[model samples]
Target: MTGTVLVTYGTTNGSTARIAETIEDVLRKAGLTTEVLAARAVASVEPYDAVVVGGGLYAGRWQKDARRFVRRHSRALAERPVWFFSSGPLDASASERDIPPVPAVRRAMTRLGVREHITFGGCLEDGARGRMAGMILRSGKGGDFRDFAAIEAWAAHVADELGRA
Candidate 1:
């Protein structure tokens, strides 16, 4: 609780990374030590007292890097307080209602005894990768749907929980 927190995320077009950075900012502002990193860049979770893992959802699954990160750090993560978040759904659905984790993420959470998981609205802008992204953009569905207020509130909650720990 008084130790460092790792806020790592996997993102393709950088939307999820922004979300993770926002989380890190709130955690740091709460007087907690926090580091934000790309999930593929984190080498270990052992140095942190808690971890927050996030990813951009694609096809009902977390991005490959996030999935691999969880798989690689399962043991260490299971020993520490861990939270998961997903950033996808290029609509206001996430803000309008509680969007549950994708099936794979739910299973991972159960297996790791993860404390909580949240799904935030995603972002898709002009330069997003993948042909599907272009298609979605062409179809007029691509836009920034992330809710910063909700994100900050969630981060504050995490900080509160950690303070209690």
Candidate 2:
């Protein structure tokens, strides 16, 4: 397909945004037109042929901006090829195995007929915001756990699927 893809994401400390950019890069490299934007900054999905939405997981829920974005654009998203991803596992679990979406994301996916969903490891560092983040850092759990190789593979898969569609 020769259509543009929008890669939008909600991030707390920017790791999820990085993942979204990574996806955008792969799609572009595969000859697909693409744009990467923060989830909250997206005014509409009507301009894109396909979309990939991602959020940083916190307390078992997607970042507020992501949830709001989905709710706001449900109708448009339902009519298009949409994929979902979550980033927020300050450990190796996400990289080590398949981490399913939280319940709310699952419901949204089913409701919107999302093409696929994935969970990638998250990153938290010294300057991350939030009290909980500070606590996690103090407790020695903060680190960058995102597996770029896995992220690239997933993006490649998305590009392939989009081509077939």
TM-score of 2: 0.99
lDDT string for model 2 (1-165, tens) is 888899999998899999999999999999999999999999999999999999999999999999999999999999999999999999999988999999999999999999999999999999999999999999999999999999999999999999999
Off by over 4 Å in 2: none
**C-alpha RMSD by candidate, in order:** 0.5, 0.5
Clashing residue pairs, candidate 1? none
What would the TM-scores of all predictions be? Answer: 0.99, 0.99
- What's the distance in Å from true for residue 151, model 1? 0.2
Error of 2 at 65 (Å): 0.8
Span of 10 residues, lowest total lDDT, candidate 2: 1-10
Q: lDDT for every model?
A: 0.96, 0.96
